[model samples]
Target: MLVDKVAEILAETAAEVIEPRFRALADGDVSEKAPGELVTVADREAELIIAERLRGLLPVPVVGEEAVSADPSLVKAVCSEPAVWLVDPLDGTGNFVAGRPEYAVMAALIKDGETVAAWIWQPTTRLGYTAELGGGAWRNGERLRRAPAGGGPAALRGVVLSRFMPPDLRTAVDARTGGIGTLAPGSRCSGVEYPRVAEGDQDFTLFWRTLPWDHAPGSLLVTEAGGVSARLDGDPYRVGRDVEGLLVAADEESWQQVRRELGLRPVDLA
Candidate 1:
């Protein structure tokens, strides 16, 4: 009941709040949170809108990326809360600033240390994805199902690999897969890869690091869409803890072959 409403509001509010900001990108005020990291006024404004609307739904705490950077302990504390809203407003600020269409407003509902619901709204196209625990995933009100497109090691579409990934791992990935297409959209901050995999835009999404707010929403989205997400060691994802490394593949065959090539164990299988 409440969960259904949460998914609906997230899809609605995100479109409403993010539209104006998208129009103002050229003239938007941009600032750096650190060297090479940026945030726009839209980020703050969008986050404010999201947080306020979420607060109306419940008294649960919100841990936003911009808000938590000043004091990361807030995230640690929120993980202890029975319910918390995790948000990454304007994820892919670089892409947003460069006038690309990959940016999004990301949010997830975490309860008892597990993500139960998530929404990823791509403001430009008005495409929104939502998922609830044990409930199926949806894109624009239609249920999502994964399609196995990439055929074996050679026919994969774009591989969403981060630049922050280790060189050795990258080498291993390249060696096992011949002439694989690589797509580095940068800043996996908002779970961009998760939905991309679900929609068959990308065959695989790899992460050498994990952020709770960033990954939680997309994790459920990907898995709910019939894909599989696992830690580098191949364990089922459990946020509020470090993944050591993470990899999300479109199917079990992809997961098994990729993990074996990297000499990494899937967390839960073995």
Candidate 2:
């Protein structure tokens, strides 16, 4: 299976490139790709290895995070190409650098701009999550099925990724957080956050930035696990779309409740 192959590739690449550098980065190992955005040698090297291995499996363009960072035009392949692979070599670089065990390596196979299969591998825990378009999601060979909807707004627990949100929107979301059962700052890693939502560890997650590499893998996993992953306006999440504000929850009812509680509306990026 392609998902199984990709999982193995991610795991092998992480073991060879990522784990060795965890908390052992030298002074020259890290640098800024943009203001406030960090990239490390491991991220670049792992991306190269993963991209190469994926291309070998299927001859398609690999729109890896580091590759897109180097060549912004490559991002267009995500939506324009018939088939592509989205790769996040090292998610949560800050946590990984700080010796936190919250980082992961993720990849998603997108066909016709929809994620068909995805994988998230956590190096520290050696946990691998895989999901296919119609196939269910799994963690370490165990199928994942989110608990049924049973919570109202006041009983919901969630995380809000507001760091990239507009000030007005952030203020609006913050005002509504008081209505939920529990709200915490996210793990700052979609690889971790998505699995948490799927496994019922968290009831919901609201993300302001909808980067394809970051959300593509996890969105499929959440939905495959019987969760709801959609945009603020209740649109299903599509890879390569330049939209913002995605809300993922344990079920459809919870998703709608969170959207209403947060007072979220369709974003106008223009």
Winning candidate number (TM-score): 2
Rate residue 151 of model 2 by lDDT.
Answer: 59
Q: Which ten residues in a row have the lowest lDDT in candidate 2?
A: 261-270
- In candidate 2, position 168 carries an lDDT of 82
Q: Each prediction's TM-score against the native?
A: 0.85, 0.97
Candidate 1: Cα lDDT at 257: 60
For each candidate in the order shown, give its overall lDDT on alpha carbons: 0.73, 0.91
Off by over 4 Å in 2: 267-270
Candidate 1 deviant stretches above 4 angstroms? 1-17, 23-28, 148-150, 158-160, 167-191, 262-270
Q: Could you give me the TM-score of model 2 versus the true structure?
A: 0.97
lDDT of 1 at 270: 26
User: Best by lDDT, which number?
Assistant: 2
